[model samples]
Target: MANYKETAKEVVKLTGGKGNITNAWHCVTRLRFNLKDKNIPDLEKIKKVPGVMGAQFSGDQFQVIIGNTVVDVFEEVEELLGGTGTGEASSNEKEGIISKLMDGISGVFTPIIPALAGTGLLKGFLALAVLTGILDTTSGLYQILNNLSDSVFYFMPFFLAVSSARKFKTSEYLALAVAGTMMYPTFLDIAKTAFMDPSVVNMTIFEVIPIPYVNYSNSVIPIIFSVILLKHVHKWVRSWMPKSLSLMFTPMITLVIVIPVALTVLGPIGSYAGEYVGKGMTWLFDTIGPLGGVVLGATFPLLVMTGMHYSLVPIAFSNRAVLGYENMIGPVNGCTNIAQAGAAFGVAVRTKNKEMRQVAISSGISALLGITEPAMYGVNVKLKRPFYYSLAGGAIAAGAAIFFNCRSFGGGGMPGLMSLPAYVHVEDSMNVVWMAVCLAIAFFSTFILTITLGFQEDAAEEVIAEAAEKKAIKNGTKHRVFAPISGKLQLLSSVNDNTFASELVGKGIAIQPDNGEVVAPISGVVSVLPDTQHAIGIVGDDGVEILVHIGIDTVKLNGEHFDFKVNKGDHIEKGQLLGTFDFEGIIAAGLDPITMVVVTNSSDFVEIMNANDEGIIFKEEELLIVL
Candidate 1:
């Protein structure tokens, strides 16, 4: 695998460096960067990076697709950016209300997906276990597992509090405090009693002012709005509060005001809004039937593309909470996901590009498992016709879903092939059968359609004068970089760090040094010499940028046992000494002395080839060819 750290650096570098980023966060598969200048990064080069599956601009977010390892890569990127990860985005950029809303919804909902998906899947399986007679609903284990799966959804406001706090840039604990008020034991008991008996209505705040006893559990908008209110309230309270007493009194005063405002006004408003929206969707779904399914299913891919899909996520939750089941929106989303996966598989079979085939197959499987961004952007959208065909498949499958009345009883996970059990109706086992049939239709129909109506794929490495390019390989106009240190030459992949090994920064080779001598790889000016004295960057006369890092992670030593002969901008020739490190000392410190010599600008060239394979070599031996 390409080293994640290096891939991260390359990702950060190609996104116009850390300075260009205003905010950085991630979703299931992509590293999302809210950039200061969206046009700065080279999207094409980012896609070519070894670990990046794809890249694109969605509004102000420059999304780098890293597949399943996105969290790992995002962590590395966070380290590179220091503590500025997820800082407040620049408020100056003008975006439509929908765009901002989508961004906000995505930010708030993304972090909770793992909890939701896991619990949701478990909920489905528990139903299966019961349906198969392996476990009884009355059994102790079944109840415990069932409640455990239900916990996230039952107390959803708390999760939203934390996530929305991060998005709105407020205190998470404070937000949780507000959610606590909404879900307080007293408040819950009163709301239950009031619901059970209509006469037991209002809970009074101050004798004259009555706060309605509304159940805020399983709620969405209330906590989010409370947090947004908290952010402003916290700031205002802190503005003039005495620094000495601020910590204690500020939270107290802030909460005293915010919670009452939330309980008395905001909570009721959000609660009613959620109910209306959920009821409205259910009514529309019941009334329109197949047309409702068709519209939602076909447009889902587009919603996902623009991140507008998240705008409906809150409504789905509300639907599950209020209506007790959803047969309208989410199942259609699952159908689209399956359809995309099917189309991706078709593209995998038909596309002659080896790289496309690799991406298609991997992305197809990911989409099948419920993550569709890879297949959607990497395969379907890129191939054009497959995306439309997949939509058609999704529309048909969704119509079938509604026509058959396939339903999701309980759970909060993405609808997909693995989540078929989510449709397990305790009262009607046929729901599962119908759900499976719908998904199968989505897969097979899209697969058949994609293969039958093939896309325009690039011809197999067509006559680029391959023979001629090979014959002109020795031309002086091409660039050559000599070995920088003496030892056993090895492929970059042999190095421990993935960044160099994966060639994500650029194509290069590694050298396991026998001695400490480091020399100029090409005759040009020294471009970068770090204060740490562990690496050197040189620009060759032919414009090939070469970076020779002395040892893996040797920068941690703070320049100890290392020396450089040339400063930045100094002239250098092939084999001329640039620096030296204590190879034995780095080894004693448990750091590898395997140096990586890379062409940092490898993307600008057609090919970057190593001069020789693994063997002992001197600093004077040819190391790389750029053509």
Candidate 2:
């Protein structure tokens, strides 16, 4: 890779420097920036930086694709910037209520995804173990595992209180203390008694004012509202309090004043609000049946595109909390996600663009894991038609799911193929089967629809020139080589090593090898195998010249580390093992171990089109289209 520090500096500069950036966050593959002014950053300049895969603007945030090494790059960038500006402000553009609500929900919940997903996976596994009789409930092991699985959800108010406090800009400890009151033993006991015996008269505050007997365990809205209220109250209290007494008295007065008000006002209001919303949703589903599912599934993709799907997160939890099972959100999420994957797969199969095909396949797998942003932004949305196809497919599958009465007893972090086991009802193994059926329906529907609808071909001059050249070479006219190693594909322009980056070794693609082994890219006679064995030149059929340079500066090792399988003038077929080098040794020697497969005689071809895809490549895979 290029010097990461230099890349960081360039990135910072191109993003209008540190001052222009308000906030910076990253997912697996991209660094998302909230900029003070979107127009200030130069998109093209950022994309041209070595190590950058691509860049784009999405949903009011600017994104820079950094591939797998995003974390390291993010650290470097963060250091260069020192500190960032305050968080995102609401958009001035007129947005629907649904859109605004979803944005707020996403802000509150996105920070806790790691904790949520880990516990959700654990719960899914625990459910599977008990249902299958692998673990008895009476066993000590089961009890410990059960607590581990339940703790997150049982005390969800505390977790949400902290996260929501951050989002609402309130005191975190104060929020937690407030949340604790909702789960206090006395309150829980009173709530439990009221739940079990409707006729019992609950104890009242001062024996005059009645307390709302409601359980806030595993509740969503109560904690969110409580923290939001805390934000305003804390600010008001802090403004007038003396600095010496501010820390102690502000918290004391805020907590003393907020707790009772929360229990008497905010808590009851939020609880009732959640309950009615759940009831309303249940009524809608019951009244409309399959149409409700169809509407949810079809609109889900569009919701996600606008960051509005998060609006359903609380609704799903509320339904589970009030009705003991959620039939709407989980099933529809699974269907929509599967449909996205299916559409991406369809694009992979139908598209002739190798880069598009590669992105489609990888992003499709990510979609199956319930992380559809890659599939959505990288493939389906980019292609246009596939996104619509996915939505249509999701609609049909959701209707089937609704008909089967599929339900999730607990909130799933992400409703995907792996988390389908979470849908298994204790008394019904068939629920899991139904979930699978829905997923299959979604996959097939979108896949078939995408193929039927097709994509508008991108035939830029370079693509057209490359296609014509490939055609000319294929019909008994010419020949080409393949990739020499298994690793991630990179452009020659993106390579870190100076000689390769400068294209002094001619034009071709680079491979960041995962293993030490190297193989012959094609049938060729080794024309120049140096004594050091760090580089090899091959003369393929019809005089196609190729070079395989193993490492950036491995020549200093002087043949000490390389194990050559073939010598100069040896004819090797495609996929033949060339040799293995010590990857660890190269690292120890302080040399970059990125390998380059270049067409040394590039001017000989009408056009040499490197595969534009950025993904893992295997030996003998088509690496370049040399005309």
Candidate 3:
């Protein structure tokens, strides 16, 4: 993997230097850049660069997809930019209502994904063990497995503490301290005593009291609230403590003060608030009856897409608290998954593209198995029709569930076949029938809708044909290499950004300029000319697209001192003067001009060879190895 510094330097060079960069941030797997000039960087070149999955511009943000390793990449990029390693940007821009809501939901859930997946796998294994009679419920093995399953639920506070701290940019230790207070042994003892005899303790510290030794194991709200309090307490203590002693006294004093406040006031308040929120959701369903289910089911898929499904988790936990079973959410989640599977099935049946069909089938199966990212991102997002079909199916299932008065009887978050026992209401024979009906509705609605609205053969065939043609072109030929710039030679891999320096995109060498003039690297036709004149793309005779981007974030300068030397679609030769840049002027304007030559059609070559070493290079010097 490319280190962070290398990635940032490359991005800086690609963007036309620091002057063109407005702001940068990252989310999950993408580096998002906001540029002053919309077009200074050569995006095609960046895309072809190694370590880059793709580049996309959406919602006024230029997003560079770096896959799962984006965080490390972002860290390196930040160091190169002379900023703190924190991934967040200091921007006052207010997000839209929808965006804010989505952010809030993601904030709450993203951190917990690993824990959830791990615990879920453990539970699945336990079920398998019992089903296969590997261990009796009374055996030590069964006991150990049960403890493992229960540990995750009990220590959720510790898990949330870490995730929330990262999200809030607070001291992780402080967050842990707060969680510890909530789950403290002393406090639990006091609570237990109080619950056993409420009248014995008259002088409450904060006009509130603990529920005397009630086990808060598997609790969520108390930890969340305590951490929120910890944020303020940590800030206060850090600010007040003397610099020399801060490393120790700050956390110690903060914990002392915050723990009491949490135990006496925040804990009870948070617990009650969570209870109310859950009750409110149940109340809404009760009042609206089947319509509520219909509405939630219909829109749940959209909520998931926008990453808002997490807001409903509190409700599920609350359901378990109040009724000893998770009723409203698990069934709905199962139905939603079914709906996604339905959509993928639809796409598979409709598309003629072999790749698309294969992706759809695989994603659809994953969705059915309760993992939906692949289907959602790779299929539904690409083809909009399947998404709507799934939504319709979900709505139908929700309606059927509500009409049947189906309710869960167990504590699982999302109900699957194993959780069917949870929804059984012993007194009502109709409960079983209702559960069966809801399941049938969810399954059949998705299956039938998808099959009926499946793919169109013509569209699939066209896509497949285009893919084949591209593949053939990639394999059929080799092309002449070009010198990206006229300067003293530097290895492309030595330029600092591993993505380019590693020649991940294609074989090319970097240049340390003896002077500041850029020439055409190859004999080719100009393809694109950005507005800022910071970048240019040329197609060589060998069918290779080479892109040259100047500096990092120079697009922010809005073409202030940049001068273009050619027009798009113009034919040019190697060593031809393509453009001239005022290196001093660009620096004075606060930009970095580290030019990069990239093969946009990198897949076409079987290999890229770097053929140059240290020396002054005229425009026509053979600087890259391409096979």
The order by descending TM-score is: 1, 2, 3
Off by over 4 Å in 2: 1-100, 199-208, 461-627
| lDDT for each residue of candidate 3 in 424-464, tens digit (9 for 90 to 100) | 44355466567766766765676677677653233423432
Specify the highest-lDDT model's number: 1
Predictions: Cα RMSD each: 16.1, 17.0, 12.4
In model 2, residue pairs whose N, Cα or C atoms come closer than 3 Å (at least 3 residues apart or on different chains), thus clashing, are none
TM-score of 1: 0.74
TM per candidate:
0.74, 0.67, 0.60
Span of 10 residues, lowest total lDDT, candidate 1: 459-468
Question: What is the lDDT for 450 in model 2?
Answer: 89
Which residue pairs in model 1 clash with each other? 3-498, 3-499, 6-499
Residue 494 Cα positional deviation in candidate 1, in Å, after optimal superposition: 46
- Pick out the ten consecutive residues of candidate 2 with the lowest summed lDDT: 459-468
Q: What value of lDDT does candidate 2 attain over all alpha carbons?
A: 0.79
